[model samples]
Target: MNDVYRIIVNHSQLISFWDFAEQPGQEAVAKGPFPYRLTEMAGPIERVEDGPFGAAAQVKLGQWWNLPRHACPELNFHGKDAKLTVLAWLKRENIPNRGCEAIAGIWNETEKKRQYCMFVNLNIWDSADQVCGHVSAVGGPTPGYKYCMTSAIGSTPIVKEEWHCVAFTYDGQYAKVYLDGVLDEREDFNPYLYDSGLFDGGDDGANFTVAAVHRSNEMGNFYTGAIGGLAVFKEALGEDELAELCKITV
Candidate 1:
């Protein structure tokens, strides 16, 4: 295993980690205590030999991975004290639509079941092409806005065709976004505070989705690029821990 995989697996709070080494048309197996597998959905994604890790999933707009909510109980993080961390190693690429990109989460905007999702270029608060940590404590938009406005938006733009480590975490107080293992600080933005905690999306809530989300009555916000690795934790990781995880080399 690579250093990144080893570090994540050793963490006590780790929920799941996907290395994206599986072949095309095969299920992406997650390694951890839960080991919940993600099924390829919508369309086929290529498995390329080149990546930050050994292999990667090269995806397009229509491709994604799905894990039914009920089937993966460990990923259903909620409640007043709920904490979470999601990290991904991705080679970003520009899409034709140029809309926000969803990396992973249980966010389902159509059903108002939004919880939390790691995103890029959310195009909100005068922000674009930056790492975003979208969180919803009410499963709907913030009181005065049409869209969910609670998020920690990073300052750095995600450059295309380059591998970068992007991540976000919630510590029951603030939602923080990180780029390349460091907090890409933006005042009142990178450490967006919301103490209400995560929303419990119940039994009929959203499914865990990767590279896309169900929004506006259809699947959209597709992340087009190569995803080399992904990991989820039940607790927010510290800055040093994230820095170490980003040190992995192919």
Candidate 2:
């Protein structure tokens, strides 16, 4: 592991990572003192050249992957009083079909439920030209569930076909989103803890899929575009550090 990762993991909670640099025919590879490997599941999700971090993964035509949740509970942030940060490079090929489209998420294993999610909210009808999204979570008890809290970005039209760095962070109170290395949006949510419960997933966290959420696993809601790279930090990165990361290019 590098000195930077050691420092980041020191204070953060759950950090899922994928660089899409797996060697040909290899069983997926992840970074860290505790390595977590992922398996490519559905089709059309291929490896390609050029990415912010390195080799990139192409997600289009309903393709995605199943990631094994990283080992060590400290690396899992789907629970309460969590400090979560997700950073990734996105290149949208076109406006995905109307309605909510998920970028990635872990929902209740039983189905039709959610724990935490990061996604772009599109219109239901194909005519609306607005662009927006949210980073949401289902906190507290189940029946008495806190109804899902969200942090959204407004009128940003993030569906364009160009590489853009996106980052989302939730530190137990407010949800902040950064786009292209700049703070794009920020929303304050009712403070509470996230409960992973049955949806905490299993073994390397392979039970969950990427480019889409466990809830909308089936259908055309999966993201249709390219993911240059992805990383999760247990703790929200300092603005200066995050800005430095955004300076990296393909």
Candidate 3:
């Protein structure tokens, strides 16, 4: 068993780039006694290459910068009445005119439906631009009936070619989105949407992927950019914690 930290008074739960660098393996920090493990679809390091933004870096599952195509790479956690959070640094080099999704949650794939366990996607269908967030309880409500919440990230294009930190937190009923540590959006999901079924867990022959979803369109198949400093937590971080997480300096 890994060393688990208990929630105590004045306990500082903070993770930094230095912490990530120091830990060579994927299962670096075991925050609590929760039944979860942080697994890297790809390793911690990747390379940056020349792109639309002069020079750029890429991070993919397993080795970084390959763009996870399918539901193969993910961080798996198992427990009831649990909260979860995921954090990542993204630098978009090429924002496709077409639709694309930058995922940051649990993903489940089945023969019938492709569920983004939790996600924040850039919707670019029919010239409509939107930044939407969603979470799904696998096999719930006949599949694909998961709860979703969305808000416009920016009125204009958000392609400044700089790194940004995106974080997501869930308290079972509600989910919140954060940009560079600031609360961008919050959603209260309908329980009935998930009443039909619960997540099949990681054992239902389902796998999760990060950064991108499974399907692709003519517009683009992968996200062209540099991604780094991804982290996951088991509980919904409180307001103070959220504030601290937002302070990440990339």
* lDDT scores of the candidates, listed in order: 0.89, 0.53, 0.41
What ranges in model 3 sit over 4 Å off? 1-46, 49-74, 77-80, 109-118, 124-132, 140-159, 186-198, 216-221
Candidates in order: C-alpha RMSD to true structure: 1.3, 5.5, 8.1
> Candidate 3: deviation at residue 211, Å?
2.4
Ranking by TM-score: 1, 2, 3
Candidate 2: Cα lDDT at 249: 37
Residues 1-250 of candidate 2 have per-residue lDDT tens digits of 4443344345344355667777544545656544566566664357677666567777765666665444335445554466666777777777546455566545332343444555655442231222222333433224544323333443344646778777666676555566666665323221222232222433434234467654334534567777776677777665576665665632
Q: Supply the TM-score for candidate 1.
A: 0.97
Find the candidate with the highest TM-score and give its number: 1
Candidate 2: where is the Cα deviation over 4 Å? 1-16, 23-26, 68-75, 95-98, 108-113, 122-149, 186-207, 216-220
Write candidate 1's Cα lDDT for 166-192 as tens digits: 989999999999888899999899888
Model 3 error, position 180 (Å): 1.4
Q: For candidate 3, what is the total of clashing residue pairs?
A: 13
lDDT tens digits by residue: candidate 3, 37-91: 3344445544454322222235433231222223222244333343556655666
Model 3 alpha-carbon miss at residue 69, Å: 16
lDDT of 2: 0.53
- Separately for all candidates shown, the number of backbone clashes (residues 3 or more apart, or on different chains) is 0, 13, 13
Give the candidate number with the greatest lDDT.
1
Task: Report lDDT (Cα) of residue 145, candidate 2.
Answer: 40
